[model samples]
Target: MKSLLLAVCLILALHCGEAAVTCETVAEDLYPCISYVAQGGSVPDTCCTGIRTLNSQAQTTEDRQSICRCIKSAMGGAPLDSINNALSLPAKCGVNLPFNPSPSTNCDSIN
Candidate 1:
């Protein structure tokens, strides 16, 4: 019983740690680009250049959402509803976004 409890505790701890890491990684990787894009700036060649590399690392919705949050946060009070509205565009326009494209891109394109 004690061993089982220890194992469960370890798993929970690891999962929590992983969640935090995922959020931080997404923010660090995507926030700067999102900020630039939000200002009516073009995605730098470097941004597109790194997309394939970053896509390979994003594997889940939480990871994607973290990046989205980072982008919205960078936008300085951009509403979540507006951001989400923006994110729906690429698919609507047949542009296949990277695994976790900034919601701002979709928002900018459509709204």
Candidate 2:
């Protein structure tokens, strides 16, 4: 019984440790990039920095999907230009993403 309990605790700890960032956290960091992406203005250093931080922090597939969901949710109320610009943001920020953040993208298949 004690071994089973220990195993369960270890599994939970591993799962918890794998998630380096949450959707809320990603939202907070990436929200600043919305204006730059919506407009055609220069991507500010702050925005790029946030993008880089997001890329580095989201290490697992779950993290990536969470970010995707947050981005999709946030973009749902945005203009077309903003959505289009979001697709271009990874390249613009020099961050390579496994899947393009688009309306049609299946975040589950990101890995």
Candidate 3:
């Protein structure tokens, strides 16, 4: 479970942008996710699916930022803020999320 959280965090950080992604970023994202889980909430399936797609598609800053935003939004408003606060990620990570993020969809499907 801990490792899964770590992976999720690392994936989120990496989705922030290649330059911004780091172990610290991973740690940052992890804190809030764990907190949310500890509060008896599960990480939304949409969030996980977003992260996975982001990890698979990440190649540029724009792509990363888009993915970050998608994941944050999937978590809904509060979790989004918590993720940003814990990760110290740029506000861009909060921008332009897709309306739908079904597991079968790709980043291109977001727009």
Candidate 4:
């Protein structure tokens, strides 16, 4: 859970660009998705809801990159097992996430 929070924060922080979105908001918006990524099952409604909210919040290149960084930071890097699940999450959740969740993804280039 902590890792997830960190990842969300870092990702949002990196993607936030000049907006300065907080790690706390990112953490709140992304916490639900972590379980799906870890366990590989149907994504919970809460998770999707959170993701949708995140999508709405991350409306800029910097915000998207910040989110990506937060996610990677949470993982301490992309955990091999959860990476695929993380990557597919946006499409499955019905949101067009602007950045990839992989640790290697360059948040600055997200736009």
Candidate 5:
């Protein structure tokens, strides 16, 4: 029936509208902050800009979880100093991240 077809099309459209955040996108957004995350130093303007952009893009719970997982993966086995610095990045950059940055953080609980 036409009604059934319409419902299927609507479902597909709604699902398609949900953009899944990818690690590649996360990496590109965080690329500018690598130096700050690597070592305790002054945060760059570019880094803050990137953070703001990433924060704005992560408007959904799923997106936030994805970003958190990508960040943890990117910092795998990193030194505590580096992780600590990474944790300070959001504050330093003046960006309020939905999830805390840490290797031990549970991405699923971010929402």
Candidate 6:
């Protein structure tokens, strides 16, 4: 049992590391913006920083699609009543996103 658990952990870690950009990574990178995205308020510099970083990091089409899926999933699960504010984050941060991040967005169609 212990060996199986360890193997599972190793496999998960390897999978995450292999992507270098995963759903967890997307969630983490955009975590700082949650408050602003959920509630209408001044977006923190850190949020913009994270957005910019996310933009730069997601260089490939695959990465962008994955990120879009991750973001959509996160937003879908968010407690916020409205995600309209979140939609403006990329533009506010001066970052252009290939796909819109919304609960209704089809992640598979991002590419």
Better of 4 and 5 by lDDT: 4
**Candidate 2: minimum summed lDDT over ten consecutive residues — where?**
8-17
Cα displacement (angstroms), candidate 3, residue 67, comes to 2.6
For candidate 3, write residues 25-110 as lDDT tens digits.
Answer: 43343344454443444454444443443354545555555554545433343344444432432222342323333333454444
Tens-digit lDDT track of model 4 for 19-80: 55555677777778878887788998998898898788887777777666666666655567
**What tens digits encode model 1's per-residue C-alpha lDDT throughout 1-111?**
344334323432333223333434544443334433344334454444344344555455554444444444443344554345335434433446544345344422321
lDDT of 2 by residue, 24-72 (tens): 5765566567567657678877878888888887778888876676566
**79: Cα error in model 5, Å:** 0.9
Give the higher-lDDT candidate: 1 or 4.
4
Per-model TM-score on C-alpha atoms: 0.39, 0.75, 0.33, 0.75, 0.78, 0.74
Instruction: Give residue 10's lDDT in candidate 2 (0 to 100).
Output: 41
Best model per TM-score: 5
For model 1, the local distance difference test gives 0.42
Candidate 4's displacement at residue 93, Å, is 0.6
Give me the candidate number with maximum lDDT: 4
TM-score of candidate 3 against the unseen true structure: 0.33
Put down candidate 5 lDDT per residue, 1-74, tens digits, no spaces: 34433432343333322347666666666667767766667988888888888899888888888777777766
Candidate 5: segments with Cα more than 4 A from true spot: 1-19
Ten contiguous residues with the weakest lDDT in model 4: 14-23
Each candidate: what lDDT? 0.42, 0.66, 0.43, 0.72, 0.70, 0.68
When summed lDDT is taken over every stretch of 10 residues in candidate 1, the lowest stretch is 12-21
Positional deviation of residue 24's Cα in model 3 after best superposition, in angstroms: 9.4
Q: Which wins on TM-score, candidate 2 or candidate 3?
A: 2
Stretches of candidate 2 above 4 Å error? 1-20
Model 1 TM-score, 2 decimals: 0.39
